[model samples]
Target: MAQGTLEVVLINAKGLENTDFLNNMDPYVIVCYGSQKRKSSIASGQGSEPEWNETFTFDVNLGDLVSPLRFWTAIVVQRMTVLEKLCNIPLESVMEEGKVPAAPYNVVKDQEFRGQIKVSLSFTHKTHRHGHGMAVQEESYGGWKQSSTY
Candidate 1:
């Protein structure tokens, strides 16, 4: 097992079924890993095609190298109802190289299909000291990217 950081870029959501009766639904995302939970800002009136471009980080201790790491994602409306739409990310796919492809999840209301949310994820391992107490080789492009918003 390796202790490191997991980076989740909450890029955007598309084709989300509007839940509000009279207006466009206000939607946000809640991401969970172990005991850590992070949320993206609500996409005010973006309706179905909402873009967040938000990033969340979690401290992770990866146990199995062969299997994928899993996390829970839920799309919420008005911060009250938890839409039946849920997503689980396979971290191993995005751990070493490319992005996690946007996959569709079933959104349900009264047991009927509502819509979907598209998300992408990426991960990078943290540098650790060697047995000889020497610093590990650092990758120039492997740290957190600074953002102006939070």
Candidate 2:
């Protein structure tokens, strides 16, 4: 399992689909991880191009099979449905190298490229208890050796 604190920088998005016909769409973002969710403030009247420059944090306690996530959300008026993208992030890579620099990720809708949002990620690993399960051998008063963890 991966354990750490994750920091996300919600930068700016460009070339988004203008959902509003007459007025610019007041756009916002909802970021989700597992059962937890976080939302960014609406960029009022920003329409297709919006800048948030927001930061969000998530507690990471994922299983070994869990991979880092890159998330996107958009509405398809034609389909009246929401879509998502799932790709593993190199958690070890981020942990080893430090923060991921600001980069553009595709804003997709129904699998079509709508725009791109610039984001950065940083991971702070949670200090595991008992050396994350490393064995500590101790000799008992009875002279028996035992493996124990505190």
RMSD of each: 8.7, 8.6
lDDT of 1 by residue, 100-131 (tens): 66555554556666566556666555776756
Off-target runs (Cα >4 Å) in candidate 1 are 65-80, 96-114, 131-133, 137-150
Clashes of each: 0, 0
lDDT of 2 at 80: 53
Model 2 residue 118 lDDT score: 79
In lDDT terms, how accurate is model 2?
0.66
lDDT of 2 by residue, 1-150 (tens): 446788888888888777667776777777776666787787877878889999999887745454455555443434353434422244555554548899887665567877787788887766544576653332223323345545
The top-ranked prediction according to lDDT is 2
Cα shift from native, residue 10, model 2 (Å): 0.3
Candidate 2 lDDT trough over 10 residues, lowest sum: 136-145
Error of 2 at 6 (Å): 0.3
**Collision pairs in model 2:** none
lDDT of 1: 0.61
